[model samples]
Target: MIDFYKYQGTGNDFILIDNSKDDFKANKVDYAIKWCDRKFGIGADGLIFIEPSTKGDFLMDFYNPDGSQSFCGNGSRCSVAFAKFLGIIKDQTNFEAIDGMHQAVISDKHVKIEMQQYGAIESIGNDHFIDTGSPHYVAYRNGVNENIVEYGKSIRYSDRFKTKGTNVNLIAEKGDRNIEIWTYERGVEAETLACGTGATACGISFAQKHNIDKGIIEVKAQGGHLRIHLEASKNDKVYQNIWLEGPAEFVFKGVIEDEN
Candidate 1:
């Protein structure tokens, strides 16, 4: 039996396994697909293994709900919690991701993740294009009808976003300093309450388009509220310290025998 812990950041949940011994690396895809099943299994956005590493604090091996390899922002937040739970690292740690090395700090109520900024900013009509670990196309306007389940997925899986697949978001400018966003994730292929990387990408797009100089922005998602801090350089290089601040709790801890 493999022991695991479950954690969620703004509704993007994950099943965490302490594969610190490196004995559980095999059969990752099949394990993720089965363990992440909604009805028959624990139901999660992905499965993460905190593998023991000599290079970084720990290596987070993340798998999407469909058993595909995908980098996740919110899932990384949970990875921080899992690492802390297992006493693998201190309150702060360095992590290795598919995109690059990442730094995450665990606070009392939230996890602060230091991520790479937008690589490219393009305009697709009113939408904005950016890559925050993962590629995202941001479309922000007023009166989106709030039926994000249909609306977000249409873009999330549309040809433009489909070939490689992209996460879609609809943002409503609630206040000058506040924004409300609804997200449709690619791997999950559904409108989840919140998306960490999506929030960061959208926030950067909004800041750039508006030519605003604010560093802190409050982002409200369908699941919860989080804050983003933006830092940009004179040469137009964007750097960000985004905090997906919310309650992350240990929902359950148990073990399951490998069926395969």
Candidate 2:
């Protein structure tokens, strides 16, 4: 049997395994597919292994349900919370993810992680594309409707991104420093309740368009609320000091029979 803990951040859930001892040796891709199946196993958007890290507090090895790898924002936050639960760190921590190094802080259930600096946003036709750890295609709409899955698939599988695929986000400006967002994750191939990188991308896109120098952008996702703090350069293009903050909560824990 394999012990695991389940965690969620704004409804983007994950199955977390403590591999710091390096005892689990099953194929990750195969297990990620098997364990993430809703009907067959512990359902989750992804799977993460907390491995020992020489460079930082821990190493976040994350994989999407489909076995694809990427730098996940909410997954990273959950990893931080899990690290604390395991008595790895206190309030602050620096960790290594697939993207590189990241710094995070935990206060109760709320976790905030610092994102890497991003360059100018790329305009594709009328939409926008930005890589906030994960590549996202942001479309500004009057309102986020139910057609997100269909519309998102059209863009995600387009010639430009079909090779590797990209996360699609439909966003609508709510008011000053606030926006509503819906995300279609590439690996899941469906609309998730929330997406961390997608929310960050929408916030940055809104900031660049509105020429906001520095402030917090409130994002309302289908699952919950997230706050994005950013500081834009004088040109209103380059962005730095970006932080993604939201609630990372423990859902449950159990042991699963090793199918491998």
Candidate 3:
């Protein structure tokens, strides 16, 4: 049996296993695809392995339900919280993900992570595309009845992004500093309650479109609220010192029989 902890940031849930001792022997990709099944297995948006890191406090190895790998922001937050639960770090930590090293701080259930700096935002008609560890296409919408999954799939599977695919975000501006967002993740291939990288990309796009160089954008998603802080330089062409803050909660812990 393998011990696991379940966690969620906003509503993007994950199964976490502490593999620092190198005890997990199953093929990670196969295990993620099998265990992340909603109807047949533990059911989660993704799976994460917390392993020993030579560069930071720990390494976050994240895999989507489809067995695709990426640097997940929400999963990183949950990983930080899980690390705290395991007494690996106190209050703050520097962890490594697929993107690179990241710094994070935890206060209660609220966790804040420093995101990587992005160089530019690609314009796609009225929409925007940016990479915040994960690639995202942000489309602005104003209160309309539409099937998000269908619309999102159109863009995610479009010829431009069909090869590797990109996450899609449907966003509506609420105010200068607030916005509502919905995300369709590529790897999960569905609309999730929230996506941290998508939220960050939308926040940055909003800032660029509104001519706001530095500020916090309150992002309201289907799952919960997140705050994105952005600082831009060189006439808002490069964004740096971005931070994503939100609640990461521990749901439960259990043991699973290693079927592999």
TM-scores for every candidate against the unseen true structure? 0.92, 0.97, 0.98
lDDT of each: 0.79, 0.92, 0.92
lDDT order of candidates, top first: 2, 3, 1
Per-model root-mean-square deviation over C-alphas: 1.9, 1.1, 1.0
Error of 1 at 91 (Å): 1.2
lDDT of 3 at 258: 78
Better of 1 and 2 by TM-score: 2
TM-score of 1: 0.92
Which lDDT value does model 2 have at 187? Answer: 91
Model 1: CA > 4 A from native: 235-237, 240-246
Give every collision pair in model 3.
Answer: none
Q: Model 1: how large is the Cα RMSD against the reference?
A: 1.9
For residue 83, what is the lDDT in candidate 1?
85
Which lDDT tens digits does candidate 1 get at residues 167-250?
A: 878888987768988888887778787888888887787787767665876888887887777766563436545444455657
* Model 2 TM-score, all chains together: 0.97
Model 3 residue runs over 4 Å out of place are none
Residue-by-residue lDDT tens digits, candidate 3, 104-161 = 9999899999997455898889999999999999999978355779988999889999
